[model samples]
Target: MAASSDAACPADPPAIDLRGLTKRFGRTTAVEDLSLTVGRGEVFGFLGPNGAGKSTTIRILLGLVRASAGSATLFGDDVRDVRRAHRHVAYVPADVSLWPSLTGAEILRLLERTGSAVDHEYRGLLVERFALDLDRAAKTYSTGNRQKVALIAAFATRAPLLILDEPTSGLDPLMDREFRRCVIEARDRGQTVFLSSHLLDEVEALCDRVAILRSGRLVEVARIAELRRLRRTEVEVSFTGQPPDLTRTPGVLETQDLGDSRLRFTLSGAAAPALRTLASSEIQTIEVRVPTLEEIFLEYYGGQDR
Candidate 1:
């Protein structure tokens, strides 16, 4: 009898799930009480600064390392059951390595053969788009070229889930944009992406939701927009005349004078009062800047040991 696709695995499980996951190495703890879920077909970002345990958590999820405490599942299958769970997932490490004797083309072919299915046509297009010189030997490829090979291989797999750890680290700005486009296309094809990175702009542009890690703990998890809403806005104004006083404004936090009629201030919550105060001045130019992910991360866990 032919095997049934749904016999062992159900369709409704989340793409990724963790509960109180922790890992300790002797006297040090790498990850602590971390928990989050990535929905099917969702682009979820796992973000943290260096030594914050982002890579440790990803290793546990990939079954490359065992968690000292708690549980992690991929598509409702325990990560410990590597053969079963990992068959549905594809991974791209931050630092990619290949056989010295193999050409980029050979490396790609080898990786594709290891997967259950390969989208050869798409893979070819990606190779061209990335400007990868696949004819060259793997030993001859530059950092960016090696990265391109890994990215193309991972993206070409017809796996239901993609686990990318700092996948764009070696790419130039143009390649980075191309990588984002490929991620969106994967999402459109109903594949889930778990992207781990310290690059705030990448997460801001691609992820639907984000989980931020700090000193081995899960600190915050929310939609990107919701997280942004919690941050204070930085506003700067240059006046034709003297700037109006904003110290009395309800939402204003800190104020500074940039000299020559320019004022800079941070506003939390509503901006109505701040706007009213700005209107009272003869404004020459104004600029409002939203908080970046790094700023938000610092706000939560800055000036502390990791």
Candidate 2:
């Protein structure tokens, strides 16, 4: 029997979805009313300072810690449905610990056999590229080497979703770049990567969108460009003549005079009026730079200690 054209196809679900997620331990609340969605093939950045409940949120998604409220779903399956959701997720924790007696190769083999859907060919390349010594025991590896093993295994799994929590904390500069390359490659392969890292520059480089958390609540979720638009720009102008009067100028927040030629000021909102003031003088040089992700992160986490 043939199905009719009117038959409806199932709609694809997002890679990760949360609705009014919350968690509390006894008297303290860890996460509160947080909700977010990470679409398939998206590299999403989760950022927050210490004690911001980032770990609690992740644990809820992993089903390691139960949420006090709301729900978490992966690919349309509730996170509580561990069999289905877990199968699609490969996770790398902030600190990776393995069986001391197992060699790197042995550990990888076990991970594959556990049904993470490892691509053997890709695993071999990762082992070589990450410079992992398969013959060495896990107990003998340095912090960086241990991270390499975890990263290699997780990336090789080829799971539809990769959840990395500060995965590059132990890597050196060179290896850091390598990790970034791997993340880019993962996104290109249409794999979803949920990266929780304190590395603002790394997030800015790799993430299509970022969600910032403060205390137990979500503060902002936006693309990098959109986030930048909400920030103030720093402007510096070197003049050949007396600095033009910027007094009572719209959009100018703070102004500082550097020597007799250079002036620095912070600009918010529109810049056209400020630029006109700078142009009135014989400008020798000018620098207009947007705030970095670190600056934006500070804007959210600064002042109040939690």
Candidate 3:
């Protein structure tokens, strides 16, 4: 994925900016000293495990909750001034709940009226694309359908900024694809997207940059490629004879004896030194496993010292 064309520089005010944002509830701190920026027209991912402060940060940005300290801004306007900043924003929560007596179409119209502008043509297109049945009452719709309704409304508003909190939670695989497409289309139209998700694959596929949080603290923020570079590959080797001793090999982080002439080790950085070490043994079979996004995420939690 390429970086956003309008990525905010040092001198540029970001589409969304949070500086030392903190939130507390009595004795518990939900967020702490967190800060980041989402550029104009960027699909930025706020990623973390459950209760990792993703929702708290988003709520502050949306002005649904006031931060205990620090500041948040939308399009250069302080989010504390809710009305003005919210005029350019649209939000879709993770768990969507609509008025039970209203039909999907009615709900859509109501949401549209709240926004500054609505694209009727785009609304119609989204309804069709999501395969939503607008005639049905809201209470009769499934969780996925309710999500579709919210998505359609958000996309149709033509808002300059979209805040989607796990927007694909109840969507099937097919609808998930359509949702991603809509996000990309929004980006193409110069809209900024702040996507909060625990789904690593979704973030990897869509985001220009990702900020990872752990224990209510920001852990890392980098492009996907840069994050991937931090991962180490696992290599398993089986030999006809004795396995080569690789304890001192460069780039080899750890080694394990799998017994019966088999060995397992993790290789970081370049594979050249590891490969040469493996070649010294009578290799019968070898397997190299690339780390998955989940594994990389766990690594951060498991070894914070990294």
What lDDT would each prediction earn against the true structure?
A: 0.90, 0.91, 0.90
Q: Kindly report which residue pairs in candidate 3 clash with one another.
A: none
lDDT of 2 by residue, 10-88 (tens): 8799999999999999999999999999999999999998899999999988889889999999989999877887988
Answer with 2 or 3, whichever has the higher lDDT.
2
Off by over 4 Å in 2: 1-11, 245-249, 276-281
| Candidate 1 lDDT, 1-306, residue by residue in tens | 999867876569898889999999998999998888899999999988899999998899889899999999998999999899888888999999999889999898888777749898999999999999988999998888899999999899889999999999889999999999999999999999999987888998999999988889888899987887799899998998667888788989889888988889988888888888888889989999998877887788767655
What would the TM-scores of all predictions be?
0.87, 0.91, 0.84
Model 3 Cα lDDT, one tens digit per residue, 250-294: 989889888988989998888899889888888999999887667
Two-way TM-score contest, 1 vs 3, winner: 1
Window of ten residues with lowest summed lDDT in model 2: 297-306
- Least lDDT summed over 10 consecutive residues: which range in candidate 3? 297-306
How many clashes (backbone N, Cα, C below 3 Å) per candidate? 0, 0, 0
Residue 257 lDDT in candidate 2: 88
Query: Between candidates 1 and 2, which one is better according to lDDT?
Result: 2
Worst 10 residues of 1 by lDDT: 297-306
